[model samples]
Target chain A: MKHSLSSLLLAAVLPVALVACAPSEAGTTTDGGLSGKLTLTGSSTIAPLALEIAKRFEERHPDVRIDVQTGGSSRGISDARSGLADIGMASRRLKDGEIELTAHAIAQDGVCMILHASNVVASLTDDQVRAIYLGEIENWSEVGGEDAPITVVNKAAGRATLEVFTKHFGLDEKEIQADVIVGDNEQGIKTVAGNPDSIGYVSIGTAEYSAGSDVAIKLLPANGITASTASVGSGSFPIGRPLNLVTFGEVSKLQRAYIDFCRSAEVHDLVTGLYFVPVRTAQ
Target chain B: MKVKSTDRILVWSLRAASATAGSLVLLILCFLVLESVEGITRVGAGRFLNDPGWHPSQGAESEFSLVPMIAATIASTIGAILLAGPVGVLAAVFCRFYAPPKLARAFRSIVELLAGIPSVVYGFWGLVTLVPLVRELAPPGASLLAGILVLAMMIVPTVALLAFAALKNVPPGHLEGATALGLSRWTTIVKVVFPSAASGLGVAIVLGTMRAIGETMAVLMVCGNITKVPSSLFDPVRTLTANIALELGYATQEHRAVLFVSGLALMIMIVLLVFVQERLQRRARLA
Candidate 1:
């Protein structure tokens, strides 16, 4: 028995013994924020966009590599406010009086209410949209669509898109029943497209980004007008909101360079192509 | 007729005790029933149990299956056990059989220190260290390897401490009997010491599994937060707790309900595991 126990001990220790010798990288890159390096996190909605801008800036100035991660807008703002991140990105404007980080409006984005392309819904009134999201309108036939229940697709808490959409549609303070909480834009769309009776809101940019993909979801025109930059800029789309790149009150030279590049025409062109309205230009 | 004084007091206390206990159980039951009503209604009993995909948004059919989440939870916890179980048991053995008095005391102190460290700090370390390591070693990097590795590190102290305490309780007389039988040191430990403590070790394993399954922060940091089943050692994976933490804040109605369903499943699994441990203990004693 003693020998057996000893053998068991050896069995457990062997694998762990092999793992204790984990290697560590020995070099440090000096960059813009702190003396050693800078890391940023928060907001998945803007993370991909931020990555593109960060890559462009890093190439021009190789001294700093700003690492970004996505949690959500609340996490982004909170992390930046707590000094954990050098920058925070938000698809919606920061809640009033955010003194911790100076706000920078990088671009404008709007929400498009989408359904499966097979669904016969033509458009949704602002009141009908509100009622549906508020848990008042549960069936599609009630809203002149079909005889099916409407499955709501909402963003998870802290996502900037949810915040913006809730406010734009006046669904705040009302009970909204979500069928599922999606972790990312891609997943949210996937959930909506797979269901004929589901309606979800996503950034116009995301819908644009998803263009040419075989997603069966169709964007329903809100207020009887198609959702687009032209519709939004021309006061035709009612659910338009801002896409912002926010950062601390003061930052290092490299961080500033990154910000400048975000406003450049090359990035703006990408934003326009992706269906998001670009508010900045090369000038 | 007037009750006897002792009978009156006993009856009153029983009434009070039962009311409190019964109410507590009822409240919990009510909460679970209300929380899960949508899924229970949508999928009915048989479909909810047998269906796959777990998509609450699948509409008409009412996708309430928990397959992906169950897969993730089991995968993460099992991964953690695989990572922490051996290391912890070995540490306990070293403390019990090999360490000198001062060294053992020091190890005890260190293990206690590790046990006291909060889940958030472990999560932070996982985010900083484990994620990068996983990204480097695995093809995709930020995958299950990182989550498993970090959870193992976080839970080892728990298993080690439990094993050490159990080993310490082994009767000195048993060791003496084995030694008197001319058994070697290894034989005495493996044969005599181990059998006597198997029940305690089982409890230790159960406790470690509890910590591993219920752990939120550390697992959240390294698991990569993807909802898909893991294909490789390094693919990003999401667990039940991570899903709750990530989705709870914004989830409403059915989304919130689904999160609660996952929570319910997790709680049930833990309860069943502990129950099995108790059964095993009973069997071991009976034998």
Candidate 2:
């Protein structure tokens, strides 16, 4: 009986041990000689681009594994400083206090106000947008639209879009009276598309794609500059931020290779495909 | 002697399995308390009570209040229960008493199947279908009412299945006695069977409430997730679980710890609710 019980326990534990040890042995050998793993963490805006770049990089090297994680730009800075990740992706330029890290611009993404296609209000001045977000202008008629209460959709804290939107509008994040708070660009677009009275700001790339498609949303021009990938590439868009690959200090040979590949023209199609303007053309 | 040894081994293994299950809850509680210490001490407990808003990313100006979120959670859960309880019970009663045998079985299976559906699917359905329908009636359809309705739908199966079981537990002898006394079918179900199954039905409602309160994905997707006390059913609100789900992905340092504090608050609320339900059940049993 004791023998049978001991064997039963061993049978249960053996498979789990084998599964845990399988990943280390799975690295393929190739002539490229890069066999180490890299972890890049940070801004959700840059994560998709990073994932694509990582995928291509892995195909070339075969032995290199890249893991990309998204937690917002602040997490990118902190994780880079703490050595938790080999590289970090931040959608904004490095702030003054974060000068210790070096940034490599991979792409540019613009933030644009989005409203349901049914909204008659075409464009909003900076002040009008600020006033609407601050709850001073409650009704759409107050902003040259219908006589319905405007629903202000704000991004949740820690999202790069929220930081960029707030900084550009000069509105304090806390002071904005938001009716709905969405997490991602897709969610924001969905919310605005679902409600005619709702207004939200999301990635220009995402909004343009959705608008071009059958989605019932339209991008509002920011500060008289047309909110489009063309304006962003021409550097005429005022509310644009660089999608950066950040490193804390001296990088490893493999990390440098991956970062350079991300900035290179090889991944330009991937960048444009996701609606983000490639840094080479933007510059 | 070999059979005796086998029985001993079987009993010991069962005891070990139960012990592991019991200790895991304690381990989680300890971990939550340990993690939330920094948030509670640095952010100060008073802020959770005094402030009405949540702004975790504002550096020194950050407020760590859980009031609005807790109120939202409680309000939504209660609202969902109020909507789901009677309808679920009645549906179960219909399946048991009124429906044809084949139809009753089919209906019961359908209700059970709803319990198997993932909450994310329900959230997606609510986001696409229900939100737009509500917007036709009230613009900005991602309001508290949408959350309540979605949650009520999600937990209806739980309440219905439990109520069905409770109803089934009513003895054959009681129905026989009611029939012998010339009581109508409705009267027998209302006056005799209902009172006997009242405690079990209460349990079902409490379980449904528990499911609604702990739900995060469905509510987060449907609810507007605004950090404010909803003034009306149409007003958007963010629940405690939704707050944690939305922000914990990027939360760090004191901010991350505060998210843990939110989690601890949820755990405490659920534990307290279960405790209250247990006490009520015991009191009812005693009476």
State the lDDT of candidate 1 residue by residue for B1-287, as single tens digits. 33355455555555655665688677776787678777456446565456654444323543555665677788878888987888898889889988898999999999989998998787767655555455454322345777787778778998999888888878888988888899987888788887888887777888899988898877765565655566666666678888888766544446567777777788888889989788867855653
Which residue pairs overlap in candidate 2's backbone? none
Stretches of candidate 1 off by over 4 Å are A1-158, A162-283, B1-26, B43-65, B283-287
Give the least accurate 10-residue stretch of model 2 chain B, judged by summed lDDT: B278-287
The CAPRI class of candidate 2 is acceptable
| Most accurate candidate by TM-score | 2
**lDDT, candidate 1, A38-108, per-residue tens:** 56566676777778777766666666666877766766776677766777676777777586577676777
DockQ for each of the predicted structures, in order?
Answer: 0.05, 0.46
Candidate 2 deviant stretches above 4 angstroms: A1-11, A14-33, A281-283, B1-16, B277-287
Model 1 deviation from the true structure expressed as Cα RMSD, one decimal place: 19.1
Give lDDT tens digits, candidate 2, residues A168-218. 999999899998899989999988888889999999999999999989999
